[model samples]
Structures are given as C-alpha cells and as structure tokens.
Target: MNSVSYDAAQRITLGMKASDCRFIMDEWLHRDAPCTLTVRRAKTKGLLCVVADINPNENPDGLYFLSWCVQHLNSRVKVDIKRL
Candidate 1:
C-alpha cells in the first residue's frame, strides 16, 4: 500500500481557517501526537472524509461536521494506476 508522506500531508489541510488546521498538524508533527489516518467508505458514494472542521453544534444540512486532521486520514493508496 502507498502512503502519503509528511511533505504531502503538510500540503493537505482542511477547514476554512488554514492557520487552525496548520496548528493541528504542527501539534501532531512537532508535539508527537498520536495522530491517526483513517478512511471511510460511503457505499455508493465512493468515500467520505472529514478534511476540515466545521460547526458540529450547527449541523449544516443535517450533517454534523467535526474537526478532522491528517491524523484521521488514510495515507495508504488503495487504487491501481496505469502508465500512459
């Protein structure tokens, strides 16, 4: 399985506030947090991931969006690619 590197993870972030997300990543990377990468399959929708932190109290469209960091993301690549 292929996984996302720290460099790439640094580039990927979620939430409207980049600073907030950056802070979270920084904590995980620098502070040695037990950050985990996770992935969820959405039946026919392919996949669903919380790439950012939204208002959990205020469920927009009846969907509660909580804050998510790279820790909760799946770095492994589960797809097959062909060279052109």
Candidate 2:
C-alpha cells in the first residue's frame, strides 16, 4: 500500500465532506484503482491521509492529480508521500 499525508499550515476543518471524497473517488481517480481518504485533527491543524493500492512511482500522473485535488481543496496544506 502507498499513502500520502497532508499537513495543513493553519488550523482547518477536521474532516472532508462526503461529497468531496465522492468527487475524488468517482471523478478524479476514476481511471485508476480506488483509494481511501482519512481526515484527522492534529493539534490545531488538520491532517489528510490518502491510502491506495497502487505505487506512486509507477503512476506519477495519478499521484499528481491526487495531490492537486487535495491542494485544490485546501491551499494551505502540504503533502508528504510515503510507501508502505
């Protein structure tokens, strides 16, 4: 599994709307395999965790789109990609 974690610069909402997740799953990542988005509160900031079965190195464009989608939602957020 591969995961990307986003840490927000400023405090924001703790969770993403279901509609937004649906948009990402059904619209943005529709071509590739499905993924999971998990949102949590980190102290005063927000954290978004994206987990997918695909390896990011093998699909840079998909990763880019995923990152873009997250950033589009919250510009203040920065991403940290991880492989597991």
Candidate 3:
C-alpha cells in the first residue's frame, strides 16, 4: 500500500470508485502476482508500456494498485503482470 501512489485520496484523483478499486485488487490477487511494476513510454508512438513481474512474497495489494494505475492511464498499453 505504501509502495503505491494510489490510495483513498489518490483514487479520487484517478477517478476510480471504491468498488472498482476493490475489484482490481481482487483480480490482481488471483490473476497478477505482485512484484516489480514498471511503466515506460514508447519513443516512437508515445505509448506507455506497463510491466509487472510476479513475486509471491511481495505485497499483492500494492502491486494491484500499481497495475491498475498503469492500465487506467492507457488501456491500450501493454501489461505483463503474471505469475512467475
């Protein structure tokens, strides 16, 4: 939770509802394992790519928020937060 910039206040800034946030966390816990989350922009098309590697020992909720923020910023962007 502390690792991520998104929280109750940040969630409002990001235009995310409480329920939506919960859903994303749940999905992340079950689908995406928490690890290192990275967001990079493509030099050519100016698109962002979010990549997250799975770390079972890491904080799942924090990684979930990171993943959610990455995707929320650009749905079309790539995401690779899977079990390792």
Candidate 4:
C-alpha cells in the first residue's frame, strides 16, 4: 500500500468548489487502485488536510495521478504533497 497526503497552509478560499473535490475522489475511485480518501479539518481555520491510501499493486500511477491533481488544482488553491 502507498500513502499520500496533501495539505494547504490556508483554507482553499478561491474558486475551489465542492464539485472539484468530488471529481477528484470520483476519478480516483474509477481507477484500478483500491483506495480511500480522507479529509480532516485542521486546527487552523482555512487549512486543508487530505490523505489517500492506495494499493500500489493495483495502480502504479497513483502517485503521478495525485501529483497531477495537485497541479490541476493549483490554480484554484495551492496544495502541497506533504507525504508520499
């Protein structure tokens, strides 16, 4: 299994819509990887914390996909890969 974590220093206040978040999760689910997406509220008001656990055996491209997501969403809100 492989784990990836994404965190934003500030709350995603720009054009980040709920649909965008859902779309990412939906796309992930549609992939071959057996995975789970977890979002948690941070102590800071606007901070975003997201964690994904995926079966590497099932999806070798999981990391690349996640990195792409980060870049794609960067325009809306800045998210960094905290862990890999």
Candidate 5:
C-alpha cells in the first residue's frame, strides 16, 4: 500500500513534547528525521511506528501525526492545531 498522506493521516501534534516529537511539515513542524507512520491491520487497536526523531526548525502545526501508539490510541492527546 502507498504511504498515507499528511492530510489523510490524523494530525497528532497535541501535548507532545517538541523535544520528544519532531515536526516535518515545513515550518509547521520541524523534525530531525521524517516520521514514518505505518497503519496496523490488527483486529484490535492499531499502533504507529515511531521509528526515529529529529529536530524542529519552526513552530509546529499543533497536530503532528495520527495516534499509532497504543497509549495514545482512543485517547485525547493534546496538541496545538497550529503546530500540526
């Protein structure tokens, strides 16, 4: 399958520490490395692949990426829409 586009994917820039998560949307969010988010076909909740992290260049779009992690799954992770 093709990789999911930023728009198709749920922005997840909420409440996540910029230091922890790297933004990749131009000035919207900076990243040391582009995050590769993969969709899980699990019968249960799916998880994201948080492979590597980078550094930020500009402000984040608030929403970073979708909740691929189980911890964030089905939960409200806070982040600035402007950052995503």
Candidate 6:
C-alpha cells in the first residue's frame, strides 16, 4: 500500500483515535520489530486499545498478530477495521 494508506491501515489495526494518536504512534514506532499486537475493544467502556508485546516464540509480525486476534475473537466482539 501507499504511505498514507499504509499508515491509515496501521491506525485502524492499532485502534487509535485522534485524541491520543500521537502517544500511540510514538509507542508503536519506538517498539522494535518482531512484535505481537493485542487489540482490545472493551464492551463496558466501548473503547479500543492496542498493545504491542515484543517476545520470542510468538507470532512476530504486526499484521499476523492482527489476523490472529481477529481469528481468536471470532467476531464475538466487533473489530473496527474501517475506523481512522
């Protein structure tokens, strides 16, 4: 994808919004590659949060982690891919 599209995609996959996007972006870029991402959309608060964990023996690609998370959730809770 192009740079803007790629960044937009990443923002969606990261569950970032305009308010706190800078902090999230900073944290995401500061993280080294070969990381795993955890995306949570809380039912109670109706908030979406993304956390990246860098550990061995886990799926190392960010996109892979996103796919895995979607599979794991099994659409029980909605993952908003179109946001951002």
Clashes of 2: 0
TM-score of each: 0.25, 0.42, 0.32, 0.47, 0.21, 0.34
How do the residues 4-61 of candidate 4 rate in per-residue lDDT, one tens digit apiece? Answer: 4333121221223455667676777777543455666544565455555544455536
Report how far off residue 65 is in candidate 1 (Å): 17
lDDT score of residue 47 within candidate 4: 47
lDDT of 1 by residue, 1-84 (tens): 432232222212222233434454565556443334223332434333213222223323111111233334333212221111
Candidate 6: where is the Cα deviation over 4 Å? Answer: 1-9, 13-33, 36-48, 51-60, 82-84
What's the CA error at residue 58 for candidate 3, in Å? 2.8
Each model's lDDT comes to 0.31, 0.46, 0.43, 0.51, 0.31, 0.44
Among all candidates shown, the one with the greatest TM-score: 4
- How much is 17 displaced in model 5, in angstroms? 9.8
Can you tell me which runs of candidate 3 are displaced by over 4 Å?
A: 1-36, 74-76, 81-83
Query: How many residue pairs of model 1 clash at the backbone?
Result: 4
The residue pairs found clashing in candidate 2 are none
Lowest summed-lDDT stretch of 10 residues in model 3?
6-15
Residues forming the 10-long window of minimal summed lDDT in candidate 4? 6-15
lDDT of 6 by residue, 1-84 (tens): 312123333333444343343444455456563454455654446456665433223343665544454454554433344423
Per residue, candidate 3 scores C-alpha lDDT tens digits across 1-84 of 123332222211222334444454466567554444343444435344444443334444654556566576464333332222
State how far residue 38 of model 2 sits from its true place (Å). Answer: 10
| Error in Å for residue 16 of model 3 | 18
TM-score for predicted model 4 compared with the true structure: 0.47
User: Which residue pairs show backbone clashes in model 4?
Assistant: 11-46
What's the lDDT for residue 11 in model 6? 36
Candidate 2's residue-wise lDDT over 1-84, tens digit each?
Answer: 324534211111223444555665566546564333444434433333344333444444545566667776674434454434
Better of 3 and 6 by lDDT: 6
